[model samples]
Structures are given as structure tokens and as C-alpha cells.
Target: MTTPESALPMVVPATDLPARVRIHEVGARDGLQNEKTAVPTSVKAEFVHRLADAGLTTIEATSFVHPKWVPQLADAEDLFPQLADLRGIALPVLVPNQRGLDRALALGARRVAVFASATESFAKANLNRSLDESLAVFDPVVRQAKDADVHVRGYVSMCFGDPWEGAVPFHQVVRVCKALRDMGCDELSLGDTIGVATPGHVLELLSLLNEEGVPTNVIGVHFHDTYGQALANTYAALEHGVTTVDASAGGLGGCPYAKSATGNLATEDLVWMLQGLGIETGVDLGKLTATSVWMAEQLGRPSPSRTVRALSHQE
Candidate 1:
């Protein structure tokens, strides 16, 4: 059987490189949100500190979504206060709507991410609104965030493929991204929510984004590992001048829409690759893996990260 890496297109180093590539650790928020068991607030705070210690400049602290929607993150108010105690850390929270943003702002969140989808089905299922309607709903939130001087990131989900609607149109993804940009979003993250993207598709869409005059610096990639293609996809995006990438520790995330799919790219695996390529992630691979393993033990299950598995066995 051919592996995912085998199927990936050959990587050609880009002639021009960006000043730096920033990897935002979303393990504490996105990673843990989908977990079956609720991780304790202390564990979540410690995990955030650990990720910061491992040299992650930006860490998604938590979401302010309703506890009824995500009981796992019921301690958002408590969690937000803890971020104040940790210095030199840029923490962003996931805000689903104006209410969510209000909660985050009240808690002193400096940055917020609003999520929308390129596919209609995903938008409806994920947020109970149509794609266009969701964008319309986000209009006020974006305006308010800008007025509040809070940095806002717009997440375009199913940019590659949607479980409900396979092979999302590139034009659709571009349309949403452009709308978000026009709405004053500081950055946009093209998300592979189901991990079904290939290197060819990524290059094609990236080329489209470039043609549309979307600045590469403000664009990021959030790839899932459902088909084990996250790393290859990351390398492809990096070659295309994508400067920011979102990943989770221990491969700990999943889409509620895609039942059989895996989570985001593992931070441990991503850092390992970057380090091997002489890239500076400023993250300690060993310590990162140790933190992942500890979380795995707490969850009473082994992490899905390949790097963590390999490194943990040596201990």
C-alpha cells in the first residue's frame, strides 16, 4: 500500500523565503476541545505554559463558546484569568459570535478568531447558519473587534474538502477569504478540516490566493491528519510562502462533522520536520513530546502523534 507521503508531489524548495514562519500552537484549545474527556483547568493552564516554554510564540488559550455547547471548556472565564499570570505569551481565544467575542473581551483576550466555512453544509452543521449568512452575522463582530483593537483571525474551514460536500471549489474558498479580508480580518487560516487535501490541490489554491492579491504573510494553514497527509501539506504550504501554520500537540483534535477523520497536524511532528530542515521553531522536541505523553496519560489513551510515539518509546 502506498503511504500518504509517497503520494505527495515532490517538494521543491522555494527560491524566495519569508522572513519567518510562525507555528501557532492550538493544542490547548482546538486540540482539547474535541477530546472525549474534559481536561482539568489546571492541566489546561499548565499545558499552555508548557507550550509557551517550548518556544511557541502564539498559543490558542481557549474558547468562550457556551458551556452547553462545549462542556469540556466550561472554565473559559477561569482560564482567561490564568493567561494574565503568564507573561510574554500571545494568547487568542476562539469566539463563535458577538456573544463569544464579548465573553473573550471581558476576560481580556487580546486576539480572537471567528470561524466560517467555505462549504454550505459544514457552515450549517457547524454553526447553524448558511455560509453567506454566517459571514453576514460575522460583520458586526469583525467591526466591533476592530473598534476594540483586538486582532482578529478568520478561519475558512473545508477549504480543501468537506466531508458532506467533497472537493470544495477553490473559487468558494477564495470568495470567503476575500470577504474576510474585506471585513478587516487581520489574518486568514485556510483549514483542511477533514485532512483530505493533497499537495497538488494546496499549490493550486495557494496560486489562486496569490492571483487574488491575498498577502501570503496574513495567510495560514490548518491541516488535519485524517489521511496522514498533514506534514506533506505543511511542506507544500511552506514552499508557497505561507508564514503561519496551526497545529496541535499530540495530534489531539478532530472535526465534529467528520466522524472518521483525525485531528490537526501534530506539533511534535511539525517541529521535528522543521528542525531537521534547519528551520527555527524555537520548540524543544523532547520536552514537547514529554508534555504530550503526560496529557495522553491523563486522558488514559495513547497520543496519535508519530513523533511522540517514537520519542516516548526511548524513555
Candidate 2:
């Protein structure tokens, strides 16, 4: 009768932390998209539903990129409508272009995201366009989504480091962020795509963004665990008054376009930290870990989340 919360961290309240944090759950879309093989559309739908049941309010459901570009999430058309009954939870889908946006909007997707990069190399590699060109591409997509009364989230990748071009400049990251904000994105999610961010670097970039007119309320942080700094960076963000975080359940996925990127910060692990800090996340840690455990079983592999393994007692 062991429960996941049996080993929970002692909640020591942090005066600087936000009263509540919104976790933008990405396991269903960003996580599963990296899978070598696509799970069935039914499985994908269930994963999203299970995540909601676990108290994840913002679940990234799927991507609307063309099948040729992302075969795993090609089921965006078949999968989104299945979650029609999931009221009260936000289901965001990645819409890579105007066409992708069309597909998402047609299926009644109210929340959509567009991916951009801060480095030219990552832009060329991931989007096959220069940084400026990539921004131009998203211009119409973001415009149209906003026009349709849809919520648009702009994801700025490689904010900290780029494998092709090491250690990005703070101003360069801020420029792309400004462009997204100017282009009418409702909010921005800064990505530590390569997981090379430290707390100082995270804090500095955040300060620059704030200086450049991006309000703390409209900014979210997405970090990878490659260097094991995701949690520390997240704490830096929380200390900066940022409340939105991007994490995946069971630490299931990485950036499919960036080979150097690793799994995202695990929701359970982040929840553990937030819970320990006595910061409210509204996530049921036990139910969330159990859901990840169930998903790991379906994937035929152990979850990479340390918290999940510890709670489930897996080696």
C-alpha cells in the first residue's frame, strides 16, 4: 500500500516563491513526439486524459506539423477532438505554420504554440531558415491565431546555448523574445534547449528580458535536464517572480530537432521541488507519479524521472 507521496519532501515555505505555479505539461506533445515510434492515437489521447486526471491543468496535447515533418504527432487531427469532454483543462497544441494553425483551429484548439529559436544555427537546423526568416514565418501564424481569438504561446528555443554556436548572448535572446511579443504572442516560454543554463545565467537572462519590456507575468521557463540544472534554474525563475513552468511527465521527451537536447524537467521532480518549497502547483504528486508509471509501462521502459523511480521504487 505504498503511495507516491509516502516519501514527499518536507514543505519548507520559501518567502520568495510564488503562491501558485502553473505547470505547462508537455509529455503528450513535446514528450511523445521524440519517441522512436508513435504510440497509437488512442494511447496518446489516454495519456492526455490521464495527465488531466492527475491535476495537470495545462497539458500540451499534440503537434499539428505535417506528418512528414513529425510522423509521431501526425495524429493531431485524430487525437484532439477525442479530448472534447475534458473541460476545465487547457489543451495546447503546437502549430508550426499557418497550415498547422489551420488544422489546430479547425479542430477547436483554443490554445496553440509556435516554436522559434534564438540562434541562427538552430534556426537553420530545426526550421531550415535563418532566425529572421523563422520569425517571419511565425508572423502570420501568430497573427491569424490571435485574430481567431486563440491563445498564442511563443516558445523561444536555444535561449541559453546552441550546440552549433556556444553560449548565446543575452541581447540576442531578448531580441527574438521582443519580436514574438510584438507579433502578438500572448505569452513566451524561454527554452534552455541544450540544458546548459545555470542559475546565474538564468537570472541574468530573465533580468534582461524584464528590462527589454517583457513582463514577468507573460514569461514561462522551459528547461532541459542534460546538465542537471533544470531545478536550480527553475528556482531562479521562481525567485524572479515567474510562475509558469514547462515540464514533461516521467521526463519522457526531448527536442526532436535538437540532437543535443535531452529530456525536459520532469513534472514529478518539479512538483517535488515546488511542494517542498511550499509553493502551490495544484498538481496531485501521487496521482501524477502514478500516471507516469503507467505511461512508462506502456512505453516498455522505465521512467527517467528520479522522483518517479523513487516513489515507485524502481531501480
Candidate 3:
């Protein structure tokens, strides 16, 4: 079989990197939540199925937030049940409060995430609550989910830099991260919401989190590509022994509050690098590119991912 020049890269394994990495795919949820015009419910379902078919194991299905807040996901009630047919895939949904949690639990969702912010400014802007107040809101949500034996992911956004409060100090982020760990979060994702983080800054935060008692195994990195440093920052995280990564397929979404912020690190771009480095992510580059291209058609825009554009014939 001939490998398409666009499809394959030579594998060259390196030392000091994790043998395998788990990509926390957020395309179906994070990628689509900000669309000005919501994609159809059936198309959203098909996108998730295609992502799973392309070997992404962990897919964030959707958010259960109220329609008034994020009208894009108003179909959560109708959509969650459609995904039950998928087997052996971990479908996690974002729950903003007790009401969001209740709706998710009622739909039989076993994995859920509560998004928090490392800076007070972002918490106030994104959740319309103070940093501590937002955590307070999630405390019972996490506790109740734990009581039900459900897995919880705590997302600490604006971990590196904040638009309102620029260059957030490491100590501020540490406090928020520690709070989530103490609240029984099974895993934590540190987010560079403004896409301003450098490789050194990323390594420093991961090292500090380790010293502060947050193990690398339970921590994932979510980087934005605004400054074009996302891949560099991610490489630094991998060198520090962090394996799980959060990426948006085709590089779809950005911080709505931060106008300068770009999309999340593209999954196609990440997979191409992992494949070249011989890191096993279990993501099929060919099929994943095709999925992104198909999704791009749904949005009537070309994908922003360099790798997707390079590898996809449809694009």
C-alpha cells in the first residue's frame, strides 16, 4: 500500500517522552460551543461518531448549560441519548452548576467536568462569579458526582496569562489548582486561555504543580496557539512527564472573552508531531483529517489546522 505524501510521516522515537499519550478530545463540545450559528443536532452526533471512528477514545460530548447561556448546546437533552450507542468510549460533558449536573446525571453521563479559572478576572468574566465563588459553586457538584461514583475533571482555565489580569502569577494559579485537588477532582487540566504561554512558563507551572502535590499523571495541558507557541509548550509539558493533552480537532475554538486568543492546539497538528516522534496516541491521522474537513464543510469554512490542510484531500 502506498502512503499518501499528505498522510504519513516517518516515525522516529525519542527518549524522555511518554511511550503513549492520551488526547482528551474536545472538538465535539469545546470546538462547537462558540459557533455563532449552531450546527444541526444530527450533524453534531455524526461528528462525534466520526471522531470515535478515527480512534479518539475520550470525546467531550457537550455541555448541559442552559440554552439562555449557550444556545448552541440546547440540544444536549436530545443529543446525549444519541451517543449511548457508542461502546467503550468515555463521553464527558461539562456541568456548570447543580442544575447542569442534574441534567447530565439524568442522561446517564458517567464522566463530567467542572471548569474553573486560575485568575479572579477570568472567573468573573467567564462564570460571572469570583474565583472563590465559582469554586464554591462546584464544590457540591463535585461532591455529589463523587457520591454517585462518577469521574470528575477540574479544568483550571487562564492558568498562564489572563486578558484582564495579564501575566498571572504562578502562586495565584497554584491556589486554584490546590483547591480543586482538595475537592476530590480525579483529574485537572491547566489551561493557557490566552495562548500567551511559552515553553519555559509551561514547564515552570507543571513543576510547581508537582511540588504543590498535584501529580503529573492526573494533570493535562490545554494550550492555545495565539502566539504560535502551543506545540512548543506542549513539548515542554511532555518532557516534564505530563501525558494527557487537551486539543480541539481542526483547531476550532478560542476564548470568547479574550479577543486576541486563538484556537486550542489543533489535534491534527498534535497527532502529526506525535506520529513523527513515535508517540502512540492511537489517533488515525488520515481519518482524523477527513473528519475535520467534513466538519469544516458543515461550518462553511476551511480548517485552521496546518496539518489538516496538508493531509486532507477534501480540504
lDDT comparing candidate 2 with the true structure: 0.93
Error of 3 at 240 (Å): 0.4
Model 1 accuracy (lDDT, Cα): 0.86
What is the lDDT for 143 in model 1? 89
Candidate 3: residue 147 Cα off by (Å): 0.4
List the lowest-lDDT window of 10 residues for candidate 2.
1-10
lDDT of each: 0.86, 0.93, 0.92
Comparison by TM-score, 2 against 3, better one: 2
- Highest-scoring model, lDDT: 2
Answer with 1 or 2, whichever has the higher lDDT.
Answer: 2
- Pick the winner on TM-score between candidates 1 and 2: 2
CA RMSD (A), model 3: 1.5
TM-score of 2: 0.98
Once superposed on the true structure, which residue ranges of model 1 sit more than 4 Å away at CA?
1-19
Where in model 2 is the C-alpha error above 4 Å? 1-5
Estimated TM-score for each candidate? 0.93, 0.98, 0.97
- What digit string (tens of lDDT, one per residue) describes model 2 on residues 1-315? 135344889889998779999999999988998888879999888888988988899999999998998899988889999999999999999988999999999999999999999999999988899999999999999999999999999999999999989999998999999999999999999999989999999999999898889999999999999999999999999999999999999998998778988999999999999999998888888889889998999899999999999998867
